[model samples]
Target chain A: MTMIVKKTTQLIAGLIFLYGIYVIIHGHLTPGGGFAGGVIIAGSFILLILAFGSDFLRLTREEAGSTLYENLAILIVVFLAVSGLLATGKIFFLNWIPKGTPGELVSAGILPLYNIFVGIEVAASVLTIFLALVIFKEELAE
Target chain B: METAICIIAGLMIIGALYAIHAKDLLSAVIACGIVGYGLVICFLLLKAPDLAIVQIVVETITLIIMVAVVLDSSREEHFVKPDGKGYMSMAAAVVMTAVLLYFFILAVGMLDPFGSGSLRMASQYINGAVELTGSVNLVTGVVFDFRGYDTLGEATILVTAVLGVITILRLKGRK
Candidate 1:
């Protein structure tokens, strides 16, 4: 990668990641929810990696942590689902949290929570896929 | 809106054909990306901003990954001239495509015209949805609260796919 690419990525990647978080946080009021926001987040990381080169992340070691986060995020999502049943004892994925006023940041109750965790899971999973492929290619070259 | 979508669909078909016929692998991949982005335009025209956002980002990432692979491996695609057997296969493909197109037209004719679907199931979610789920976005409420099980299934499928990719690509299986 060139110095120009690296500098441009440094300037742009953070903004892209922040936009992804914004989309996830506003999922209740917005069109993009977990999946779209998460992918955007992953796209930022992928851009960073492509510009900086795989060696910047030390991907082989970081790969384990990425997988761990991916699994943990999904587990949290499932836990939230089951908690709906255990807490309310009414139904699975019940919106048990008290609904605040609609259109506000904190209004969506369990929906925003679901979006955040799902966003994390998706972001982690997608990054892991890219990292795996890049690392495999690196290893093959070696 | 219909005119815009129709134009985009035409462009998508052209892009698809070029992708299939292009000898340069990288150019073919980019042509495929044109089709994907054209669908994003169609999504926006249809008023599904959520789908459009997702499609555009996913399409970009897919393009990047494909370009990376093609650049590292090979730039040119090997093309073989069609023989008699190939011509036979091509004829079969043409017939199959015609039959599929006929069925597609039939299916499209049966569908409810755009913007006036019977909201038999969705009516419940639409009425008092903001109050019931406290999300102004009815789609989010339906997806995460009313139909959380389906979202869970979708997430699980993604996880399983990533798991499979990791398993296949990992440098070592056992320590």
Candidate 2:
């Protein structure tokens, strides 16, 4: 709540966000995947809220924007899975793209894409819930 | 390793007991978080890094969400005096705990030694995951490829939960 705390949060939030993206992208090779990374990303935003209050972060967008973003991410995931099924003509979620060499970033067909999409959906949903709680608390206090 | 695990498990039990018995709701929530972190340590000791990662993050978020809930409501827990019926229920709980612990120990002993399981399914995944999924991490390969449909189901559940929260929390003209 202090100025020092806000400054420190601002300094570290970027790094935390970057680390979340790294975890999400390198999920295939690392222990952390979409869910974990997404939580971390949401945690960074939570830290911002704690340090500066929700009013400061509410300038970006309202709760509806976050819900829309989450829905879009889930829609992308479903579309990808269905397109894979249609392309392969075998089964849903089939890996139709060419499997690149293992250990490479682009090796896992659809896996990384799925991870990214899930990460987005998770992050958006969590932030939305958090913001909603904050707004509700404010309303109750009023 | 066994001794370390035993110590962690002991701490976990202590944390859980404190969480259940703490008078202050905030302290109880914090104690639950301690138990969650202790389980994460147990997962790491068991060589399940993926589970550990997921557990740690999920535990943190769960703690945050619970704390938010507690913050919005009363902080003091009303203690109920146990009557004769409560004593009987407590006795039954103690017996259940003892029985469950005995069965758990017996099952642990019956399990194959660590790193020595010869399950056919595990072997196939270890041997074929990279070739089949083009991912070096067999866990990821299995989760996102071999069991992609299951992952889809999980994602759907998450979306459903988000929608449910939105619907329940929606306030008129308060976008």
Candidate 3:
């Protein structure tokens, strides 16, 4: 709302956004997963909007890009699942990739990928919803 | 620890009651957020760090969405005098609460002691998850490996919700 608020929000939002990425990347080994990390990411953007007002809405005006990203993430997940079926002929969501060491980042076959994809879908979808609400309110006010 | 949990539970109940009865919609939403935070605390006490993380984030998002909705709408709720129908609904609610509470107490009393109930699948997962899924986090293993279909359905639901929001907000003659 104020210049001080906007400045502080800009400073903290990057950290919050980075934390969300860290959570998503470490989802296989950490408590936070795709959904939680995605929400945290969305919260950072939401905080930016809350502090800076509708001026930030210009960034989200290209709604098609966000929607495409959201859909693309889900499509990748579904494609992975389907390709797993085709590759393994066992079942859907089969872990086709090599299972490395237990604690390593690349250990979980397809699980981390799923987490990352889900995080992307969730983050994009949340931002889309927030953008829609803000734009709608602006239109109503007009 | 038990006393702390009990106090938190008590506060959660009070928050829920206040949320239901508060005239200011914004305060009511904040009260709901309080109840959500109490549940997050309970999750932590139960040693479910994963659930606690998810709950806190989800609760925050829910609070933001609710606040946005409230901001776009009227602030104060118009009070209507209770008529016969209102009294009837209140009595119905009381009766339902009493019945549910009785059943809940009975169920709790019948349950096995903490940490000893139905460990068949849980023990299997705890023992085999790392070996089978190659993931150190058993919760993540079960979520992504064992229950992948469920997660897919949840993702579908989220996408549908986003699509619905976009459709509803779309202006006429705009793509």
Candidate 4:
């Protein structure tokens, strides 16, 4: 990869990730939600990997073990949702906490928590998908 | 109502037929991709982004897998499928798409004799999220909420796909 392509992809990926955060936060008011935003963020990270080199991404993902993160994400979501049910019986998965304030970053209840979880899951899963793909070809030519 | 679906369905079928009839199969794959995109538009109009996203992702994977298979096989003597499509099969495909589209439009359109759905159960979760959970993101609130089971199921599907592929292609060597 030339310096130009590397710089370009990194720039694009960074924009995508920032947009993802914007969407995740204002998700309540916008048509785009956590899932879509999360995907976009993951796409940004993927771009970063493509621009730089798989070596670093591999090191990062290897240390994390995407599968573990994916499983944990599922468990965390389930646990969080169930906790709401047990406490208030508020129709399972209900926020069950205080609305806090409305505009502040931490105003909403469970919104931020799930957003973070989704962010992690999306980052790991998208990388895992690509990692699995590269496995098809024993080695990536630089 | 039914007329528009018929036209859309007709165009889809024509694209597919042309795709198949074309000498090169790669063009046909692209044609199918276009058709898939059209179907996604229809799904969106019906107000189900979930279905639309799922269809697009699934088709993308399918296309990738197909391309991979073709690439692997192209190295060999040749690659092929059924000799040709019978006239009946073509007719059946068009008719089925049209019929299904008609029913779907009718179901989702303003013709649902009854007013908007009760949505009471849905409200319990959506409204509850903001009031109690303090969560600003509703999609997450619901997904991670009581309906978290379905999300887990989706994750399981991914795991299964990975495991299945790993098993099919042993670590010994590339197939």
User: Which candidate ranks first by lDDT, i.e. highest?
Assistant: 1
Poorly placed runs, candidate 3 (over 4 Å): A56-60
DockQ of candidates 1 onward, in order? 0.85, 0.72, 0.80, 0.30
In model 1, the runs with Cα more than 4 Å from the true position are none
lDDT score for candidate 2 against the true structure = 0.85
Of candidate 1 chain A, the 10-residue stretch with the lowest lDDT total is: A56-65
User: How is the predicted docking of candidate 2 categorized under the CAPRI scheme?
Assistant: medium
Q: Which pairs clash (backbone N, Cα, C closer than 3 Å) in model 2?
A: none
- Residues B51-91, candidate 1: write the lDDT tens digits: 89989989999999999999999898887899999999999
Stretches of model 4 off by over 4 angstroms after superposition: A1-4, A49-64, A85-94, A101-108, A139-142, B1-26, B39-146, B163-175
Residue A129 in candidate 2, Cα distance off native in Å: 1.9
Full candidate order by TM-score, most accurate first: 1, 3, 2, 4
Put the candidates in lDDT order, highest first: 1, 3, 2, 4
Which digits, one per residue and each the tens of the lDDT, describe model 2 over residues B33-81?
9889999989998999988988998899889889979987999998889
lDDT of each: 0.90, 0.85, 0.88, 0.62
How many pairs of residues in model 3 come into backbone collision?
0
TM-score of each: 0.95, 0.91, 0.94, 0.64
List per-model TM-scores for chain B: 0.91, 0.86, 0.90, 0.56
Q: What value does the interface RMSD of model 3 take?
A: 1.0
Q: Is the docking of candidate 4 incorrect, acceptable, medium or high quality?
A: acceptable
* Residue pairs in candidate 3 whose N, alpha carbon or C atoms collide under 3 angstroms: none
Query: lDDT (0-100) at residue B12 of candidate 2?
Result: 88
